[model samples]
Target chain A: MFDWLFRYANPARFMGLSGALLPWLWSAALLTLATALYLGFSAPPDYQQGRTVLILFIHVPAAIMATNVYACMVVASLFSLINRHILADVAARTAAPLGAIFTLLALITGSLWGKPMWGTWWVWDGRLTSTLVQFFLYLGYIALWNAIEDETRAARICAVLALVGAVNIPIIKFSVDWWATLHQGESIMSGNLAGPFLVPFLVMMLFYMLLFVCLWLTRIRTLILERRLRSLMGAA
Target chain B: MNFDLSPYGAFIWPAYAVSALLLGGLTLWAMARWRAVKAKLATLEKT
Candidate 1:
């Protein structure tokens, strides 16, 4: 299984595979997101939060992708460190900004939802604070990658930073349960949200995950092409 | 369909508007960057 998987570790083979898949991936992501938005908007207003609950369709998915994207980077970074795969390092490096953008969306949308529901725009609660820290970790990782001039040095250093920052992923996941917080703790999994609300949430989650995969593949392909262009220029 | 978000419409509409802007903007930007990179690679290869 591992040997078969490593066959695509070659950049050219990875490019061919990703290129063939990009159109289908983008189409599926758009389709799911559209269906999710339609369902989310049409759902009845919550007894407590009213239409503001609609924000969950976007915010919750963004939050999920935000953390998951970081996890992806950590895995990619580990592959780069262990296997010395340049493409894996490129995958990790390209994903940081996208993850940061998702994290930013989560923060902003959560704040928007919070004001109407929780009666505040920001809270220093464990979940909220840890998520905020996760956002900074993405920024720091991207900055470290950009600051280092040597590709090998940057990959090694960034992989270490990615590994270190991964400690926050579990903290972010479990924060609401670990401490009493303004953020609601584990609603979908805990059976707190009704089916009416949960279905659309799940749909949006799937859409967002698909979107991350699509975007990550696009960025990786672009980075590979970028490296090819650079080497060509150097050779010329 | 109902434009009545009542007291929270102001918050809810803008929240979605921001989400749409961010997600859509990022998607377009990434695709565009990919296209540009591919084009540059083509030109370099030709040269």
Candidate 2:
């Protein structure tokens, strides 16, 4: 079952495989994203929120990706810690910037959505504050990775941080329920989302996840090349 | 087909604008890094 993973564990082989997949992945990502954007913009506005509802398509997906990507990193961190797999570390490391960018998008877009509705650009409510903390966790993980000199040591330390930060994911998700604050509780999974809102929002969610995959693969490939270049330079 | 923003376009547009700026910027940045690294690696492998 996992045989393919082991086969591609070799850097050179992984490079060949990713090289073949990326062009197609990029094409799919771009095409699907375009479709999602069309659907999102054309979708009818929420009855109460009016056109401000358009921001929800972007904000919801970005917020979902922020948590999903961090979850992925935590899993990768665990794999790296236990098996000491080199690519696991690479996977975890390459994902941080993408995660951070998505988190920032969520923050900004959430604020944009909140202002007309909530009458403020920023708030210190539990959901928003915990998400802000999630954003900082991403930055801290990236900084920790760069701060250490030894790659192994950095991976070990950063993996621990990533795991510790995993606690915040649930906190972010449930903050609304826990605090009854500004953020409304999760609606997408609760069957409260209207039918018209569901489809485009799901497509946008797909688009965001696809974007993450494309960039993550490219970054992994880049790291492999960088490692090979360093080895070649050293040998010369 | 005509699409109406139904007001609140101010908040709606900038949300997308920032998303595009950040996401697009990162995509281009990653591709550029890939190109530069590929070229440098190719040059080194050649010599």
Query: Candidate 2, overall lDDT?
Result: 0.83
**Candidate 2 lDDT over residue span A1-236, tens digit each:** 66777788777888888899989988888888888888877777677787676788888889888888998999989988987888888989999989999999999998988888777887666656777878998999999999998887888889999998897667655864466444455432111246787887888888898899999999999987887788899999
- Candidate 2, residues B1-47, lDDT tens digits: the string is 22577468788889999999999999999999899999999999788
> C-alpha displacement of A138 in model 1, angstroms?
0.9
Model 2 pairs in collision: none
TM-score of chain B of 2: 0.88
> Listing every candidate in turn, what is its Cα RMSD in Å to the true structure after a full C-alpha superposition?
3.2, 3.2
Q: State the number of backbone clashes in model 2.
A: 0
lDDT for predicted candidate 1 compared with the true structure: 0.83
